[model samples]
Target: MEKSEFDLIKSYFAPLASGYEEAFDLLNDAALISEKPQASTVVTMDTLIAGVHFLMSDPAGDIARKCLRVNLSDLAAMGAAAFGYSLSMAYNSQIDVGWVKEFTTALGEDQQRFSCHLIGGDTVVTPGPLTITITCFGSVARHQCLKRNTAEVGEDVWVSGDLGDSAAGLKLLNKELDVSDAEARAQLIHRYRVPEPRCDLGIELLQNAISRTAMDVSDGLLADLGHIARASNIAVELYEDKIPRSAAFSALMSSSPDLGLALAVTGGDDYEIVFTSDPAQEQAIQELSRKLSLKLSKIGKVVSGHGVRLICRNGKTFLPTKAGWTHF
Candidate 1:
């Protein structure tokens, strides 16, 4: 039997709205979000296209999770608690009911893990490759949202978890690099496929008044920090050794030190949070890190100037030929 678009939604997507009464079982054209007193809504959207954002050969479940997680990373950057998301998918002949079942199963798992619900969305057939777009909605205290321009001079720059694993993972996946260690190889590939968003850290930073300036490192760390520097009209002095790296990343770097450092600093797809806070909050930040069991590394500081500078261990400055990934 040929399945229609409505059948696709009813079978795979409608069940994702189990807890969200306002979603109306994905039958309505739109979903309603009631106002929460003294709170502001945060909305973020991201689109992923086949062969561009992800490989077509990847597992359908992973592809679905990555699509949702990237948008969740955006909400985390703003210190927002995700409530719900609206998903849109354009599928080609390559996708079938079985593939969609796996995809929606992943979304259902993530919805439970993140405490968010699926609201509504549209599905359409396209002759081109499959594409997915997700719009995530979250909430934060009124007028207390984090901003890139709110960084103050002399504040400490911090990042959650290790870096460069994702880029290394991509290299391995593309066969540009090979790892002797099977465990390390698998870890890197996993990081590339599924990025962990620092939602709790973002909320702690904003709610506790620990920091006001933050942005997730979707691009290279250097490039994203450059954003904070440019936005705040300040300069950043980053210590190359201070940038955190996992054991797998370090092993890869041990084989190629220069390339490792460059990739770690400039490689994109690291969804970790890069935030700034006053030095006085160091103890509090450390406590938060321990409480959350997430590594928070203090990598640099904001100074009065323009642009970002990477300082090497030898007290010399190191500059990359290319700053980061760019669409253009």
Candidate 2:
């Protein structure tokens, strides 16, 4: 039986948006968004395609979570709290109603977890692989939104959560990396499939005035630091040893130390928050870490110069073949 787009929306997507009065039950062509007092809306979008952003064989529910989570991560970088999102799904012939049910179920779960709703979306058939695009909306205090890195030369650089687990996870999924421990392999793969966005940390950074500049680490740490340097017109001096890694990632890359180091900074997809702050805030950041029960590492500093410089333990500079992921 062929299901019309309206049928799918009425059955699944509409329920996701029902809590939001502005969504109009997904019956209208456009949904209305009511603005909150003294709040600025933050908008970000990400598109994930089968085999490009995720493996085709990945579970439908996992794929749905990944698609929404990536966009939410962007909002977190800007110190915004997610409110709603509009989805555009371009599904290929291989996708069916069961896959969509699994997918929307996951979206519903995350929507509740994040306290956001789906306002509207479009469903279309495509010859290409399954593609999911989400334009996520978030809100922050007026004039308190974190923009590009406003890092000052000599300020400390901090990143929330560990790095490289996702990259290592991808390698394991692709059969390019090997880990002897079954648990480590499972952890890495999970990181690749699901990312934890640092939304709470972002809100604190803005509301508590911890930092004025921040960005989510989507690309490798080095590549993203370069972005911060360019945006703030400052150089970054990174201490190689300061990069954070989970027990799982360290275990997986234990045998290949060199590869492990490279993957830690260049692997990307960690979805952690990286921000520059005054050195005085170090203690405050530590307190926040304890309060939030999240790991926050000070890995580098904003320096005077151009680009990023990574200093190894041997007092030598380590250069990677690639800085981060390049879409082209």
Candidate 3:
């Protein structure tokens, strides 16, 4: 016999909603969210299809974490602190009671780690692929949220942490790339599975007034940069050499510099925050880096023009085969 939807909610999800009082214990059709004084609500949503966002063979817990973190990353981009989330899970036949247990267990752990709760959501059986959609709610200082179109000409461009590991990790999983080092393989694949949302960095950026223009690198660095550029009506001059890479990532692509760098910038899924700030903020950013213990790389600067230009190590312009990933 299969578990009923209400049974699953009581057994697994209700406990997760314990963080917020207004969740109504998930008994009501909808949960009410109220904003705090002087704080504005920040909402972000992301959908994950089994084959599209993750693999069916991937660990159920990891899939749940990834689904949640990606949306959290969006909150981080807006310099917001997450409070709770509503999850709509489209489960397929392959999902069983045991699988739900594993999935919800991870969500419980992450809720504790992120200081959030599952306010409300729906679970329905799907005839198609297993899908997860998370609508996350966060709070930010009123009228003080990061905006993509705020990049200013002559400001320094920056990226947090390393890039390309996730993309390369996916390639390793698909057997398109060969990595001989076991630790390297693990490092790359772990990045693909779990992303580190720079929540602290976002908070610092907002609280200290270090930057005003920012977004997380989700769809790929180059492609995402294009969004800021077009939105701000400015051009970006990216130095290929300045794009940071992890030791594992560098080792994996050492022999093929061109291909390696291309994949690193265009592979997407990095989830690191990218922002533009005045050159005067460099010192503050460096201090923040040390405080957060996360590497923040200034790879480029905003220029008065359109689109992005990748400057090669040889001091010449280099164009990638493709800018980034697209569903279509």
For residues 209-308, what per-residue lDDT tens digits would candidate 1 score against the true structure? Answer: 8889999988888889889888899999999889999988998779788788878878878999999999999999999999999999999999999877
**Model 2: ten consecutive residues of lowest lDDT:** 319-328
Q: Candidate 2 lDDT, tens digit per residue, 54-73?
A: 99898999899999999999
Query: How does each model score on TM-score?
Result: 0.97, 0.97, 0.97
The collision pairs in model 1 are none
lDDT of 1 at 108: 93
- Candidate lDDT values, in order: 0.89, 0.89, 0.91
